[model samples]
Target: MKFTKLTSSVLAGATLLSIMAPTASFAATSKAGSADAKTNDNGGTKLPQNDHTEVGISFGDNNSNGNTGYLRLQAVPHTLDFGNHKLLDDSKLDFTADGKNTSLSVNNTKGSFNGTNANQTTTLATGTDTALDTVKGTAWATVVDKQVTRIDPMNGPEDTSDPTNPKPTSGFHKGTDSVAGTWTLSVQATSPLTAVDNGDPSKEIVDENGAKEEIKDAKLTFSDTQYAQTQNVLGLTKDKNDNTYAKDLADLTKQPTVAPVKEITKNVSTPLVANGSDITVAKAAAGEGQGANVFGWLPENIKLTMPAGAAVSNAIYKANLTWTLNSTVA
Candidate 1:
């Protein structure tokens, strides 16, 4: 059960235009599963589609001298539309990920293990286990509304027709379809390494009552050159009916591109705030920084897959994506 609401605001924020529309609450959106890649009866995709935008982000500082200065640029919508897309699951994505992050600090210059003071004191960082760390999150996507309309490649450019109106039982037919892509992603702690901040790390973890606890700038690291997962898609139908009432009206209305496809991948390197919402962009804007961000000019990992169908069809089937990250999330 899907719904469609065409709003002017959503069109303004293409990141690729920056528009504003209050955030939509995710009261009960289903979590991503194997359905992350699926098709529908009409060949339409199920994935949410939208544009992107860039906004100033403040992720604290990186220097140890209390001169913090690390920025973050939020990507609006975080979704894409294939116009007329399809997702053939059961196909595998050659996905892979690898990255490292640090979050430990010390301050025991007065002379303690590592560093455990409140001032900018120099102290040795002792070795600690990296398994004591962990992070939890998910990553999945899907497409919806495969074919918008079946076209009859026989009309001229000047043909007069109200595309959005009720149509007649004419023999000729032609139209556009909607292909979409969407995902639900998350990240979690999964490391045995502790930020042996030997120093007093409590200041970084502010308490609800303004009190502070020591949480070293330690980090959790992981490296998986491959994040491959197979998708089992459904919703493709076989609706090839000819009602042209003629000896051979096959030329009257051309058939739509009902090609059955599989495998599509998007390589993305996104940093998830340990306990922050992965917000979506509502629109895009035209500006110097509209397309680029602090992370880089584009998504750290953004690649879409093009699956191969029948074996005798000679189409190839393969997905290869890699990503990495280095950030702080408490």
Candidate 2:
């Protein structure tokens, strides 16, 4: 490939960056278990037993149910350094909330690793502190002179109106005029339900319930952040003063705020199936690890919608989510 002087310089810079790029890697692991079992009041060293016992031999079915959630999402941290070496705006961009392992286990099912997932979402309330005191935020984000760039076509006959590349779906907004505003953030979603009330079983029919009762204590918080961490892979490069910085591309790709222009939600619900066999295990003597995999590949749909708003620098708004279970234990 041929390279002009400018292209060569850019390519050389990129290659140099590739070699000296600094990477930040972190690793963490955890294990935890909790059971809502019975306990004796006396200071007695006594053991309990399960109700389900094998013929004469008394085989105790065990259950070691647990979930170990792990989240390893990378973020890009930006630092706004003041001339005195003080940081003005340090932003930590949590681009993703990666993994949340929800699980259950029974003894005989030790080899089986399966789980059911219930969503928990909170409705964004009407009144929120969306108003950022820009005057006081001079340290976080100084309002530089906003410019209106008519990103029409370059070096071509342009028209104020065109079909294919029409005005922005976000609206034909000018620079500063569209930049600042009284942005109102609202939570919007659709919840669907279906049921088989007073079902007929004689004709081989199964009963049904609409939507599961949603869980409680959902929350949404909004705030501005500064000083985000960076992720680099090769662990080589450094800034001008040889200060290394790592920026993770994978993390940046996970932010909900950055969902593409063509994405949309459709509300739908999947039916839960309850298999026949039921085991009777006493709560007092329930051994370690004894549960079957109930949750299969079932997808429930949730439709979402909201109005567009301006995103100021070093600002972030988070929505805590939750959902109700069918309570059917199916």
For all predictions, the C-alpha RMSD in Å is 32.4, 35.0
In candidate 2, position 172 carries an lDDT of 32
Shift of residue 297 alpha carbon in model 1, Å: 24
Runs in model 1 lying further than 4 Å from the true structure: 1-139, 149-206, 210-255, 258-267, 274-330
lDDT of 2 by residue, 162-256 (tens): 67775443333332121111111112222211111223211221236533322122211122221111122122111221121112222233321
Count of steric clashes across candidates, in order: 104, 44
Worst 10 residues of 2 by lDDT: 288-297
lDDT of 2: 0.20
lDDT of 1: 0.22
What does candidate 1's lDDT look like per residue over 1-330, in tens digits?
Answer: 122334444554464233354666754333342235453322343335558999875321212222111111221112211111122222432111111001111211221112222212111111131211111011221121212123334433543477677445344433221211111222232221122222442223334795433222222112221121111111111012212212122342453232221221122232222332222211111111111121111111222222234121111111112221112211
C-alpha TM-score for every candidate: 0.18, 0.16
